[model samples]
Target: MKQREYYFDNAKFLLIFFVVFGHFIQSFIKESNSIYALYKVIYTFHMPAFILISGFFAKGIYQQGYIQKYAKKLILPYIIFQLIYSVFYYFLYGKSTFNVEPLNPHWSLWFLISLFFWNMMLLLFAKIKPVFGLVIALLLGLSVGFVDWTTSYLSLTRTFVFFPLFLIGFYMKKEHFIWIRTKKARLTAITTFIIVFIGFYHAPSINYQWLFGSKSYSSLAEDPFQAIFIRLFFYVLSCMMIYCFFACVPNKQYFFTKLGKNTLYVYLLHGFIVRIFRVSDMTDLVNPPKSFILIIAVSFLLTLLLSSSMITSLAQPIIELKITKLQQLQKKWSNLFQGYKAKLFE
Candidate 1:
């Protein structure tokens, strides 16, 4: 197996924790001010940072067999999970349709679909000059208003908005992150985190749309020029917080490395648990004060539980299908077809 970067693994593990934490708090956004503020802070940079790290590790992704590997690991699992979530949603909400739309991803699963598109487009992105690529990605992201493709099902809006962050990671060097360990860099990073955390705490409930990157600029109903600036500001601020988050994270290997390795499993499986919480009215059933603390504690515990090795091991058979067997079966069918054709010609 290839050696792993401890820092990136650590970051991935923590980022997935934030994902679970954020989802858990969504149910309680109106229950507590502190929880709402914490949710905003988590949303601000979690996905951007996660995508950046993905791009960082995706060096040389276009190698001959990579597309095949991604199809098995990313695409196949995306389809399976999408179907699973669709069934879960239908049962929970009593939806009239069990539609599993490939183009329009279900909630949380959007990351998987977006990731697939990003990897597919890697070859195209590699052809552009870095400066030009960055400009185009930003412009396309902000110009979503011009396009009326909501029914496209391909997650075009998010794919464009988050594309720049992915490229930034693609261009990032190990030495770039090394500077964060320096005394001055540490001071600056810590201070920035303080300021941002303070802002999140005192600020009113933020329209999470700014960070979600899923809405069109026109839909926001702000002055066109002002809307453009808001998008740019969120992007810049997210980059800053992402760096600060990495700076503060431990670079040394830890027990969570295995959890990081199986982030895809945690990511896909945890949503099911969260959905159960929502559908059962678990959040509404609980009272404030004691129940609030219980929920917070449970959230962290759930995150840890979801990332545990036991959970990963138990889910592996489902997560990693026996594709080798399928490949052999396909080869056998092809051979039988060839034999039939040759015999007929003779």
Candidate 2:
């Protein structure tokens, strides 16, 4: 019998779990410095890995002209969830969910704005050459360090940070993207990554209070020479580790996979939940071990449960109807703003 393909399950599960685990540790594991250190180590890899895996499966979006399709899939869902989460965040946290902007951009919602630009770039540049497109991704990612993080969202930096990895996923060749056969390259990349990552962890983060400190965001760069090579090196290492982890993973049912499958839902819903629970001092219930473990476990579990219910449980039928309606709305939006060229003309 032919084995069934699992698509990106293992990697997706890892990514979803990391997002929860990283957030929990950042918030709840503060009592232990050792735990905080470990949390930093874990987070160094999460978003990059997620972007790479996203890139790996992106080939289809290149063919059959999935630009419109992608807008619906990623953009619409992003907006839908951002509005929903914003309300929940304020309710939960009892404070503003975002730093005040001149025009007031949502704080965490920058991920959506960044990724939307990324997908658009990929759709445009992937046509030139995959590697060229990857170059564009790097340029976009690096643009972030140059901006004032407080003043506004740096879509360029976010783009540079993630788009290459996304392309790595979208255009990934099973051969080179793997490690078993390319042991030397993978090992070299990983070894360099560890040494450099340690350096970055300790390398002076810019002084935030100084009037000129924000300039450090741009002028200083990732240090030890802030070039494209260093950035690519880390990107490769993250992707390799992800590849190796998935390749060696033992098949087992994991609740996180359910969560990953419904990442859009959690991405949309969880921030508000965090805020709501925080406001109630329910998060204060996370007093050291009990609440620490409780919030971590409950956050992942609840997000998983809610997302699964939306996608698979009795509610999916109703939810699917909603999705269909939204998709139509999405179509209208796509038609209204058809292309960059049209925008210029109008």
Candidate 3:
């Protein structure tokens, strides 16, 4: 069956907005108000939902066939950005770096690794036994949740927990997705919002961590089931929210659509932008004024505008590089498939 793709434009922007806002709030804590409270509430739902959206997108890609196609598209960018930031990190912290590096594995790059592994795993195991694939994912999640990141096992959990969620997003009940894709999407989103908002009351949000603290903290912690339960609610809300946005969004303007296209660029650049702002001591932004409402609004506007502009102007070469690599990967995969047909009988 041909999958019904949902473009839900507004949700894409909303997710991007939350992503920008969440990072800004966390980074500029010196200036923040109790407003951090609201950030925690929003984050509970944001990431899991984003993972699901990727899964939904993956459904289309899977049907098309895995080439070095998705890998080149995903991995080439990962390499470009990792090396770019590796240079950046070396310059910034390598000056007097300690024995154990703060982000040696390259923290931002974790998402790419997790995504690649998840995609590969799905491709290999899913066709033979979907349940087995799910079981493997569950085991991976469990290991990360309970096992230590620094331990002998190199696999990390925190970055990969969303693998299962990513799968769920791609496979949906047509009836349910249709209901969400319909005009009734508003109420669907509203219900999801309500559920996640309620979870905020019980969700375990990190507040006191030191700057650039170990992301391994996400590996595992207390009340695993509760966190998972909360994550479940947030995941639902995230999809509904996405559906609602698409249903209500006006025709795409060149500006916003352009921004969405370069979301990867924005995600990469914003931290540095935030750090530069932090160093400048502008707005006395540290211990910023109590109007979090205004602060968050301005932060979103500024990050989106700056990141998008920088990506278009400065990162064009990398963009071309990504396309070239993707094409090469497609060619390689096509050749492999054509030259080596599946064996007829063992």
Best by TM-score: 1
- lDDT tens string, model 2, 1-346? 1112233564566566656666555565447544444455555566666666666666675556577766666566555555555665555556655433322335455566666666676667777687777666666555544554533444445555666667767776765434443556556655755664465446434121111112324444445235445555555655655555455433445545434566655554455555555456555556755455665677567656656643343333232324553455567667877876697888
Superposed on all Cα atoms, the candidates' RMSDs to the truth, in angstroms, are 9.8, 12.0, 11.6
Q: Write the per-residue lDDT of candidate 3 for residues 90-113, one digit (tens) a residue.
A: 665554652333233455556565
Off by over 4 Å in 2: 1-4, 89-107, 149-151, 175-248, 251-260, 287-296, 310-346
In order of appearance, the predictions have TM-scores of 0.85, 0.67, 0.68
Best by lDDT: 1
Query: Worst ten-residue run, lDDT, model 1?
Result: 145-154
Q: Which stretches of candidate 3 lie over 4 Å from their true place?
A: 1-6, 28-34, 60-65, 97-104, 128-136, 150-155, 173-176, 181-188, 191-255, 286-289, 303-310, 319-346
lDDT of 1 by residue, 95-121 (tens): 997787776788877777788778877
CA error at residue 123 for candidate 1, angstroms: 0.6
Ten-residue stretch with the least lDDT total in model 2: 206-215
lDDT of 1: 0.77
The segments of candidate 1 whose C-alpha lies over 4 angstroms from its true place after superposition are 1-4, 285-293, 323-346
| Residue pairs with backbone atoms closer than 3 Å in model 1 (clashes) | 103-153, 104-153
